[model samples]
Target: MHPFVSVVIPAKNEQGNIGLLIKEISEVLHALGNIQFEVVLVNDGSKDNTVIEAKEFAAQSQCQLQVISHEASCGQSTALHTGIFHAKGEWIVTSDADGQNDPADIPALLQAAQQVQTEHFCIAGFRNKRLDTPWVRLQSKIANGIRQRFLNDGVPDSGCGLKVFPKRTFQALPYFDHMHRFLPALIKRINGKIVVCPVNHRNRAVGQSNYTAWSRAWVGVVDMFGVMWLRKRTKLPRIISEEIE
Candidate 1:
């Protein structure tokens, strides 16, 4: 049997981009013709036609597709959890539903993960040239730097929103509001490894960005501390409570 990969996309209101992204991903993966893949789209309370568009795409695609819905807008992290939990593949890859992450870059990420020779390793896409606004870029750079400095993970683009991990490992992550932004550190808490690959990024063709500068700063403040707490609170087990003679 071919190794299965699940492509998970979390969308809030990305009607314009989701359809094109779906087509592009299908084309690129079909050309590869080696790995079997499925797509799991998480529609996180979209008030737009996003779900309708995704359903249409699913109906037409040769690759298996499924949509998970959230009645209310929880957040991207929650949507990610929903998608991964629904995924039926050995490997899980997540990309922004807004079309910023290009499908052409996935092969490099998968190849890098293979080279590391560890099932515990995650493949992260480090944007070669970020297409987000300057302010968003600054916040991302700051968050990643702070995480790397304190967490020793050396991940420079934790907020890139393009990554791949074993479905089992990803599902094991502790839940949080913005866990998507700190996957590298969360993985490290359990001694997991991550590999970074420079990936292509494109400017959004439609739909306003879901993140705002102020919201980012506020959330960053809380998430940074939360990660620190997780780091400090984690303890290695040193004893066996019982042994059979």
Candidate 2:
């Protein structure tokens, strides 16, 4: 039987966090009671023992687990693409492997998505109180402000990795490098609804983050303009009625 939801996590050199995060995910999903779910862990070519640790924990996990690996380190977007495309679930929930995104909040995201009446929608997590360094928080604040102004995506914390949406809705979006960062905007461009939900955030207790503030800022600048172009050119017709013979 296919899983109802698949929690896709992209990890690189997150050995200390992967196993623990998987365990937490399993526990939370099991508590949902009769909600079939699986964890699709995409090891983004980690030089560490992330894959090994994940497999070890999967042995005792209550929910199903699938691990995919890239021969070399691909970016988070590519890892997410790999996992989501391979996931067997109808709904896809993505979370950071750093353990900052609480697995317990998965229920909240799922509940938010369930309440949405639209067939195509995205539930983006809003971190009201970020637990990052002051400098990093400032960078995010500025970047988010600019992105909102340009894309008008209405997502306060688009960088937050915790998001819930249907697998089909995600598959409909055009994929590109760093596409993960602009999900809300892309979804909106394609005429999909966007829902924002507040979720818990925690400080990293394990490995360091892969990308620095400067790196994110530079890439975000280029990606933001690219998305703006895509939005302007995208023309979705409003179908008043459709009848299939």
Candidate 3:
């Protein structure tokens, strides 16, 4: 039988962090009990031993686990897209491989998603106490403010890596580079609601940061404008009538 949930992690040169994150996720899910889940780890051309570590964990994991590899480094958006494409679960849970997002919060997201009556919606994690450098936090704050103002996504922290959503809902959205950062906005464009939940955040215990302030500013500006354009051009019908059987 197919799993009920698929947790997708996009790892790029995260050899030190991937294994522990995966193991934590497994333990949390197992403790929750009675929920069949699978872990989909995407190795986005990591130079380190990420693949080896992931494979080793998968071998010993109680729940099903699969690893997908990219020959060259693709952006996070592409890596996530690949993982979603190959996932065989009704619900998709995504988190970064850097261990900043706590695996313990997965149950909260799942519970929120389940308790809501709305079917086509997502539960996104919001880090109340972010564990990042002050400068990085400032940049994120400014960017998030701009995104919320322009896109009206109603999500305060779109940059949060932890989210739980239906697989089909994600499949309906248009794909693009850096699309992961714009999920709340994009999901809103499709007339879907997003529920933001406060989740635990931790400092990265291993590896260095992959993104710098300048690089984030440069690409974030471009992507912000592009997403704004998409939002402006998006048109969803208020109501649809169909023949009843």
Highest lDDT: give the candidate number. Answer: 2
All candidates: TM-score? 0.91, 0.96, 0.94
C-alpha lDDT (0 to 100) for residue 5 of candidate 2: 96
Question: Per-model C-alpha lDDT, please?
Answer: 0.83, 0.91, 0.88
Cα lDDT, model 1, residue 216: 67
Residue lDDT tens for model 1, 164-201: 88887786678888888788878877667888889998
Expressed as tens digits, the lDDT of each residue in 1-245 for candidate 3 is 22399999999999878888888999999887778889999989888999898878767776588889999989899999999999988999999999999999999899888876665788999998998889888988998888777778888888789999999999989999999988888888887888999999998879887767678777988998898998889887766677779
**Which candidate, 1 or 2, has the higher lDDT?**
2
Off by over 4 Å in 2: 1-3, 241-245
RMSD of 2: 1.7
Per TM-score, the best of the predicted structures is: 2
Model 2, 1-245: lDDT tens digits are 22399999999999889899999999988887878888999999899999899988878785588999999988999999999999999999999999999999998889888788887889999999888889889989999999998889989998999999899988999899899999999988877899998989998879899988799889999999999999889888888999999
Report the poorest 10 consecutive residues by lDDT, candidate 3. 54-63
